[model samples]
Target chain A: MFDTQSANFDVQGLSVALIQAELGRREGGIPIGSALISPLDPDVGTEEVPASGRIYIHGHGRNQRLQKSSAILHAEMDALEKAGRLAPEVYKKATMFTTLRFASYVHKCMCTGAILLYGIPRVVIGENTNFKGEEDLLRSRGVEVVVLDNQRCKELMREFIRYHPEEWDEDVGGSKETSARAS
Target chain B: MFDTQSANFDVQGLSVALIQAELGRREGGIPIGSALISPLDPDVGTEEVPASGRIYIHGHGRNQRLQKSSAILHAEMDALEKAGRLAPEVYKKATMFTTLRFASYVHKCMCTGAILLYGIPRVVIGENTNFKGEEDLLRSRGVEVVVLDNQRCKELMREFIRYHPEEWDEDVGGSKETSARAS
Candidate 1:
């Protein structure tokens, strides 16, 4: 939802979008139901497909057109093709709608950057690719990535244990007053 | 929009409707044509008002239900009120829509039990009387109002300065390497 391809880029002010979604069926979550998912590139001579499986990640440079990030966008396009969809006009409208909506949130985030440990924790897009490529690109851009490696994880735990302090201080004793009473 | 009156709280979530109206205008930054204002009570009654003069904030939280916080919920609510008035039923439905849609985000922030700060910047919420008592109550509850006075503001600026030391270090040396450059 947050990716902006060059075509929709603000010729004026730059902006970023952060897509947020929730899936649940309870008092505090969305009731399981249909979600309005838009097909990717609903241009003429395109097919329509269900937008519920797989994922997609798309990107565009400053001059590139229509940037998308997320496995979902691709799946939508695939769905359209598989379903032989013909709603090119509707798809185009949906694309613009999503872009504008996402851009608004992104603009808000970028304009008022939040304080974070290392540059605001952001979903950065270096090059749109598969999950692994995306992860690598983000890491290359100085983003921290946690990989599940048993040995490495164990080493980290060991190092942490080595540096653990022995001295412990809790408010157990009543301080000077308690010491005096004891004496 | 961050204000407090008595105990019952009036929390406002960001609204997509407002964003669409504000940015979807042909006038760009000019006043939108005939703003739709609605005065709706969650408890009872509904009235629609029109745009006049500068954008104004007008909404009720039923009884004394505004709470004091630096969060953007109230500001967003005020923005919606200024842009278009929603009938109580419509407002409630919209609120539900947002809550369900962004439940995960809300849950994550709420779970941390920490005050949240998020929304469009450069949006100034007018000084409100309803917030005074609520702020006092919040201080008593150990919530830190980070920018309460000049001294605190200065301290915060210094902290940011420290965090972005490389920006300052670009000239000579002194703690240059220790500070990472800002983008």
Candidate 2:
């Protein structure tokens, strides 16, 4: 069983990520979303915490305009970029929460280097998949990994696949292009 | 023994990459460099081929300005970005050349996902290292990988280490930050 009461787990951060994922899906973008919560966040009584030490960011997948091949930006990258820009100091002490497993997310877009570069210590994710090897790689690099397996997160991923079947397939199995396609 | 005379080998592209790497090192940037050559490039007689279908790009490692954590850009990503912006159609059919082996390069910066996203067919690199697993992963994804043990490339990497020992260590081992540092 998963321990939601773990001291390192941020339930509120996961809640915010779910909201961001739903918003992204409704906006016709990739449903992936990320949140970075600093340990300095002021503890509020209710579930609605102020946005002082929490950052929510989301983005679409590959840019079709760039010949449908450029994964111009991604949600996790966006969160890291924004947090790095906004509060560089606070984010270093931050815990990352996302709708997808961090390993799967990094595997899909290759942001593992950036995450390691940023020195993010802990990651709390909502889904789990066959990316256990990638997760182990991250762990070996010293980043703490946690999976929540939230039901809403799974639903959002399912919905994202239903809406963008082709992209989901390409994302799961890295895009394979034949030499003839280059001509 | 490495086959320099292979039909797919681009000796000229590797030569250009060496020039780029040297220039980058002299400019106080990371010595890594990347070149993307399109199959449609016009064959020139001499080693000095025109830059019509070849794009050379290089960059520094982590942006120290961003609290010494953000890997703002990298050579391979820069080459891909520039090529994707300049000739989106042509880049899809392009082969990448770099001073560092592609697997080591991607492992250092996590650009594997971007390379796969861009649908590049082949990669020709100068140096090879312990990133054989990463190289095999790329091969499994259908990208052709080649290693050319160019002496100049190895010299440049050694020089880069002599100049930026700390960064080189961080790049290879991946930055490991303790929770205390984050505070």
Candidate 3:
């Protein structure tokens, strides 16, 4: 449950591994960041048995921070509503939802920070205006999408090389040596 | 190296566990697809090597069949050039650059297939798109991102009864219940 949106997909048991791989790795033994939980989501109330058991969501920039905070408040209201812990009127009054767009500054800074720090490859997404900037940022560092296929096998193949460069070719065969060379 | 551009990146000293967790479990099985050494890439230049060490790249689709075929031929030529097995004119003539792109039909099909088969609780990204589609599909599955995030940490707190459902939770965390669960 590293990201709340992930839950709505068919995790097929991969979610746990994704979380472990991300959070367990450390540079200097410092945890990167804790996973954030979202309460506004519908699944939060389905299986509640404890006051402390909470869900988490993943976020990074200023927008992510805003999203995380929003999630927290949403969750609190959810918890209250589920437990019959809040007055109906109060819960109704608190039902306002705010949608926050990704902040430009934060996106630029964090995306740059990720590239600078890890040289890790990321899949860039945006409209025509931002696409070039994002693509340039990633491409300058030697990251770009080389294939998009209809088959799951092809997608998995691409992901394999992206995640495991050593076992595969860094570039020639989708391996990490390519990343090493680029870095 | 999942993508051609990754061949230029620097990814060294990263963990194998992290790679395995991210890419997919090994489970001691042969990979589904084969890897081949292609001559289209600039990396190959006539290095004497055993056939077993070489990788294969398949040409699955119709549109790019010729390019894919040519790429392999080009890689072989490059290998020869680097190894001093081929003449300089060959290098100048064969050095054709090719970048892979997924056709729109294929891209759409893949996204659609993932949704129909896996449902939500899964997020997919192509070289160009992230959070692409099927948000509504995920909503129907009751998978929500928040729940997935909660599931991410559920293992650490498995000692608590409520954190994991009796059926879905596993024995990664050592507990007295582990025995029964394993059984």
- Residue range B3-105, candidate 1, lDDT tens digits: 2231311222112222322332222221111111122332233353322222222321100001221111222222332323222233322221011111112
| Tens digits of per-residue lDDT for model 2, A39-101 | 443223234434443343322222122133433345565565444343333345567777776
- lDDT string for model 1 (A9-107, tens) is 221111111121111111221111111123344233335453433212221111100122111121111222232322323322222111111111111
Query: By the lDDT metric, which is better: model 1 or model 3?
Result: 3
Task: Score every model by TM-score.
Answer: 0.18, 0.58, 0.18
Predicted model with the maximum TM-score: 2
Error of 1 at A175 (Å): 63
Give candidate 3 misplaced runs (Cα > 4 Å): A1-23, A26-37, A41-55, A58-182, B1-183
Ranking by DockQ: 2, 3, 1
Residue B162 lDDT in model 3? 40
In order, the first chain's TM-score in every candidate is 0.16, 0.67, 0.23
Candidate fnat values, all: 0.00, 0.21, 0.00
- Backbone atom clashes (below 3 Å) for every candidate: 23, 0, 60
Q: What is residue A26's positional error in candidate 1, in angstroms?
A: 10
Off by over 4 Å in 2: A1-8, A16-27, A36-72, A82-94, A102-109, A112-121, A129-144, A169-183, B1-9, B15-23, B36-72, B83-94, B102-109, B113-121, B129-143, B173-183
TM-score of 1: 0.18
lDDT score for residue B147 of model 1 = 17
lDDT of 2: 0.54
Superposed by TM-score, candidate 3 places the C-alpha of residue A156 at a distance from the truth, in angstroms, of: 26
